[model samples]
Target: MNSVQEGRVALVTGAGSGIGAAVARKLAAQGAQVVRADITATDGGVVVDVADPRQVDELVAGLGRLDVVVHAAGVDDPRAKQRIADALEAGRPPEVTASLDAEAWRRVMSVNLDGTFHVLRAAVRAMVPRRAGTIVVVGSSSAFDAPAGYPHYAASKAGVHALAQAVAKEVIPFGVRINVVAPGPTDTGMAARTPAVLRQAFAGLPYATPEQIADVAVFLAGEESANVAGAVVLANGGRFTV
Candidate 1:
């Protein structure tokens, strides 16, 4: 892909670590003026929680002119998986769904699904007036293949894909291009915490580096994806068939 021109304003959420950080640095290297954000990031970006619609709105408003938006902020707390694993270890009947905590379920849905909605909502509003923009939502393979213990995570991701698809249709006609990058189990800290039994579902699949996914995000965020909208591009190493 050609180098993204300098001075292009870009905002990347969850930029404190993982794929979000990688994408922020990548866009910077490509000469775009990036606004890196997270709950806590040392890169001078103000703390912003994607789950809060007000925070998302204010962040976009501060940018003024948004050329690109990459929403990577989402939660994958390990405690729920650990709890299910513990229950199985303690000889309790493996009630996979019952083992998940109600609070955790709500929290995951809020941050993963609702959070994506808030970011996209704000981004669409910002991009619509300009009549040109690119949005790459970092989703997950969990939407298609739910693991044994992470029902909430899986469900939330599914919702993200649906929301992105729906929003893309509404905004594409207005020159706002929105797409999703649903990566498989990449070599992220969250993947490391998955229990063996649950992770077995993704066995034989090679993990991808955060930077690799960042590369894909950079592609979708640039003019290269001009004709692409409401698309879900998988960056997995041949793990999923579709």
Candidate 2:
């Protein structure tokens, strides 16, 4: 019912839960006709594995015209998460750098980096002809500094940031703009699963809600941020300045 994003169509990936779900709802509230895609479709959006190029291509092709594309779908398996959480504990056993779970790292990269690549490629395919669109990628602040425990997660996110910056130039001539939103520890289901000890390290920064991050995402997707492209707007709620 809002006129802010009326007539603007948007596609939100990983819309089943977490930040992706929040972004989809925010776009809808702003009056955008939002199409959602996720492995588990919670809001009646199509089920999609963003890592699959075929599925990503079909989803965007079906939309015909897209004003916004939000790629929020990413993965960090339970083992990897727990491994990082253990690091928060005092006197935790030291892990050999070479003994880490390589398979888990691959899964993280495939979903986080490959998934992002698939979505961006498909969005460009659909938007270039129209010569207009905004692509907003949900990146991670960890990418700014790949910590010891979560090396894979950090690398994958860094790849996404680099990809967006590189792709932003290619899409410039066609009138398409791409940007990234890197958020710090957000109070979502994912963050809640982590121990408080780990989160307390950044006590100086206020915890951000899903809605707060969505506000920044909506701004980047709309005309309000026309001059902002190829920029990584860190939404860490003052936790870190980068």
Candidate 3:
């Protein structure tokens, strides 16, 4: 709602929909020259996958002056999701090690962990030279709680949290800050795709709207959170305290 980001340049991954789209919109509305990058074309965003290093480089190069980076592109392991539903319906935690297929695990890790690294690496290259920028990575409550079966997703996000902390430490001397925002079960299409029972279980806990998470992200990207670095802000409304 404020114009703190006026003249800033922000690049948001997965901006085609859900929380990414919300963050992109929030940054733009706050007067940042938002480059809404994603894999799919949405109403007000550009299309680019953070997983591709070349694409990430191109996107940053096009920005001319990259000020902020919000890495939000990620995926859940499909096999784990299915197994979790079956296990929950049977009243037990799914045997992820036995049930999850390799492909599913690889897919989730590639998009969530590797993709995050790609985006952050590109952002760093673009920002370090100018010695000014911020990076807000989108982690998840699951990274802390790590629900029963989604090991791949949890592991990837955990890596994200760690990476953010490391980045913050390594880049502070360059006048760059890196942080993470872990949102709870938000009302989004991604949440809708979760099994109904799983959704209900998460719903029973505190949940925030996409806008709320966006607010936290924007704060991390702005000078308002200047003292905040190597920190992970849990936006999960008390669901998971990490």
TM per candidate: 0.92, 0.93, 0.95
The per-prediction tally of clashing pairs is 0, 0, 1
Best by lDDT: 1
TM-score of 1: 0.92
Give the Cα error of residue 196 in candidate 3, in Å: 0.9
Better of 1 and 3 by TM-score: 3
Cα lDDT of model 2 by residue, 17-86, tens digit: 8888899999998899999888885757899998788988888888878889999998865565565567
- Best candidate (score: TM-score): 3
Q: How accurate is candidate 2 locally (lDDT)?
A: 0.85
Q: What lDDT does the true structure give each of the candidates? A: 0.86, 0.85, 0.84
Model 2 Cα RMSD, 1 decimal: 1.8
| Worst-scoring 10-residue span by lDDT in model 2 | 90-99
Which residue ranges in model 3 land beyond 4 Å of their true spot? Answer: none
lDDT of 2 at 210: 81
Residue 44 CA error for candidate 3 (Å)? 4.5
Better of 1 and 3 by lDDT: 1
